[model samples]
Target chain A: MKIRIFVTLKNGVLDPQGKAIHHALESLDFKGVNDVRAGKLIELDVDDGTSDSDIEKMCEKLLANTVIENFEIERPTDQAAREA
Target chain B: MKIRIFVTLKNGVLDPQGKAIHHALESLDFKGVNDVRAGKLIELDVDDGTSDSDIEKMCEKLLANTVIENFEIERPTDQAAREA
Candidate 1:
């Protein structure tokens, strides 16, 4: 089975890369753009029996640096409904 | 309102960086780890009434380079309900 973890900075954290991209977008004449925050997405193909807690542990231990970011998990079954 | 865009390589795309990370994990003595795919996550704070269509336009035009990756969008409302 596959599990996806999305790691993002908490709201108050500063994201320099995100800011640079935001500035570049404005310079390119794209209006209506507001603020930008950047983070990482990590996809894993695990054994089918991987537990939810194991996935969480993976995020905490490897997929994310929780000191600066938060993570969300998504399963393929949930993603399928969203595909529509 | 907030819109989050996740950008990931489509299947069949080679992700050397992800492979490197996977190998690193194994070297670190973490067993049972299979493969890794790395991607980007972008978060945007927008006007309270931004439409789904506009958020999608942002993904296609700015948040992702569709030539190499695909993107998915998540609205705060949807996210909240999922939190439960």
Candidate 2:
């Protein structure tokens, strides 16, 4: 199975990288961009039998720093098609 | 309006960061982890009137490296609720 994890900074956390990107956009004259926040996407190819709890444990242990980040897991329906 | 952009490395590209993450998971004894690929998620808060073409141009110019990365744009449906 293929699982996708999105790890994003919690609201109110300072994101310098995002700020840098925002500045870059402004320099390029892309108006209307109010703010930017950056995050991470981790794609994992794992055994089909891997339990949801185990996956959650993975996130808690290393995939995310829960103190400043929140993570969402997605099991894409297209994984079956891809495996087939 | 809020938009999300997912940027992922193209297939066959070497991802050292992902490799390191995979190794870390193995060290932590997370079984069934076959492969890991890492990417970026960029969130943009923009004016409601921003055109889709302008957003696409932003991605092409700064958000993604078209030579080795692919980007997907998403306009979340819950933006209304959040703004409310």
* Candidate 1 ranges with C-alpha deviation above 4 Å: A80-84, B29-32
Best by TM-score: 2
On residues B1-84, what C-alpha lDDT tens digit does candidate 2 reach at each position? 889888999999999999999999999999999999999999999999998899999999999999999998877553333223
> Which DockQ value does candidate 2 get?
0.50
Q: Using Cα atoms with residue i matched to residue i, what is each candidate's TM-score against the true structure? A: 0.83, 0.90
Among incorrect, acceptable, medium and high, the docking class of model 1 is: medium
What tens-digit string does per-residue lDDT give for candidate 1 at A1-84? 777788999878889999987887677665566788899988888777777887787778777788988998998776655553
Q: Clashing pairs in model 1?
A: none
lDDT of 2 at A70: 99
Alpha-carbon error at A66 in model 2, in Å? 0.6
